[model samples]
Target chain A: MYSFTKPKKKQFFKEDTKLWLVFYAISVFLYVSFALFLLVKAYFYSKNNQIYNQNIITLNTKISSLTLQKENIKLQKTIYEDIMVKNSLIKDSIKNLLDLIPDPITLNKFLLKKDSLIIYGITPTKDVYNLLMLPPLESIFTKTDTTFYQMPNGWYKFKSINKLKGNNETAFN
Target chain B: MKLPSIKIKLPKLKIYGIDVIKNALFFAFYISMTLFIIAFIIAPSVKIFKNAKNSYFLSKQEFDNTKQNYRHILEQLTKLQNQNQQILNAFKRNFNENNFKLFAKDYMNIIKITKQKTIPYKNQFAKTSYIITAQIKSPKNFYDFINNIKNYKNIIRVYFPIDFEKSNKEINLTFKIETYRLLTAKAEEKAH
Candidate 1:
């Protein structure tokens, strides 16, 4: 019955509380800084969006004004072309009238009015009158009146009054 | 080296229930604070960052579109200016007064060449209208005269009538032609 008792060892909990606390503080700080950075980025993006919206508005206004000007120019060009076309028609009509005159006959006095023509001319013979009253000339006039006088100089003097027909309805407004 | 020393031992300290609860409550508060940061602050901040990135891209795209539209409009304006210049040039070429006079001289020469006698007549001029009057001999010569006048590029209107004299083969033809001429800058301003 000889029993020997051993000395008791000290009991202690092994924990690095200071290191843990420091780590947690650093983590929270990092989260907060990252959140603040995100907020700043959001603000910057919103500002950029506002600037871009303003630019778009300015551009739209400019585009609209320019479009209006372009349309105005195009309208002016159309009017010019219409005037040229009408002038060309009138010139062609005058040319056709000139071509309708018979050869070998001399013209003394020719008068053109608003919608009619008056001609006083001498022909060597009366047969030239038939030529003047022919198809092309007939088609151009709605009415024609002719009077012939025998001259002492062995020539026939004739006076012709002609009224021009209206142009086709579809040709112009 | 001598006899064994006897040591007196102290009693172990007991942890009370309230102290344990206090420690547990502290740990829970720390954990809850971390959770609160993660759930409220950090999570929402991440969402804000994502939204900001998306907005930045959208804004950039819109800016690019606006820039392109602006460039296109500028190009169109340049094209319009060129067209305006062309219209002005064409107007100058077709409506010059000196050119109209030259055309009239050429027309008179053509009448003479066609064996027609031309009566001297005065020309009437206005802001936008010109009239030249002449007399010729034969109907054929008048026809030729009209045809030759048609070759002139600037004539706008022509009116001619021939009357034949009973005494001879000669005819008196009166030609009234209309044309345009470019106005002076001052005149143009006045007209407008």
Candidate 2:
């Protein structure tokens, strides 16, 4: 009679264990390197984020200040321009009103200093002289004290001072 | 001579529970590591790319919006200044009270075919413009009033065919008229 038993597989897989260990080491190394890369990236990203936030804050402040400055400059420019325009308008109005004053006055030796105007000339006729000395006409031309000196040959020189007021509202023919 | 031999046999070994558990744990660890690579590393990089693209687009949009508004404000300011200048120039010619009175009287005389009614005068814009409201006796009076306004010097526009009430004496017609005066030459030139 012969005895019988089940047979076992040989240790052929043990020879490939080193290969599996190398594969496991490679996988672990790859995983660790990737993790480090991510860590570095995250650190840089966070640092950049902080810098960006700071920059945004600073830029926002600058923008606000710049906007305020621009508005102030605009307002100042408008105010200065308005003042210039008003001054020019007043000067032109004075010139035009003065022109409306009778041409017969024949402004000669005219000197304007401060608030006074000194005029020296001779009136062509006595009648024209009297008209200039009248109340309403005289009042328009001379809003202040006036002095006149009569010389030879029916000639007279006058010195007058006028206080400027609201531009001439009188109608001129 | 003859020789006889017997065949050899070996016993089977049973697998241990510790060895099975060890294999299962190794498999689980490898699967978890693979999942981590895909989830933590690959996904975040993709998200960063998308965000960068979006931020660039938004920045350009903001710049364009601000630039357009700046131009519009400048245009409005210029237009206002021009209109002001035009008004100043028109006043330089003559818009005195006497001229207004003369022009009004002439207009009334031309439309004498229709009955006229007195209107209260209203002044505006530092007395530069005057408004008057009156009533006409008939529709024909309204027509004549319009024509007269067109010929008037200081009178600019007239509102006629206004709401009215029917009366025994005449048809009550209410209308408004406007008159403008030019600024003095000195004021006009200065404004320019």
Lowest-lDDT window of 10 residues in candidate 1 chain B?
B118-127
Q: Tens digits of per-residue lDDT for model 1 on A45-160? A: 87887888787788888878887767655654454454455545544554565666788676666566557777677788887676654455556677778788999998888888
Interface RMSD for each candidate model?
Answer: 6.0, 17.7
Q: What is the TM-score of chain B in candidate 2?
A: 0.30
Whole-model Cα lDDT per candidate? Answer: 0.58, 0.46
Predicted structure with the largest lDDT when compared to the true one: 1
Q: Lowest-scoring 10 consecutive residues by lDDT in candidate 1 chain A?
A: A164-173
Q: What is the lDDT of residue B177 in candidate 1?
A: 48
TM-score, candidate number 2? 0.34
Candidate 1's residue-wise lDDT over B135-189, tens digit each?
3344444444445543455434443332223225444333444443334433665
Retained true contacts (fraction), each candidate = 0.50, 0.01
For all predictions, the C-alpha RMSD in Å is 12.5, 19.1
- Model 2, which residues run further than 4 Å from truth? A1-20, A40-98, A113-121, A124-143, A152-156, A165-173, B1-22, B31-192
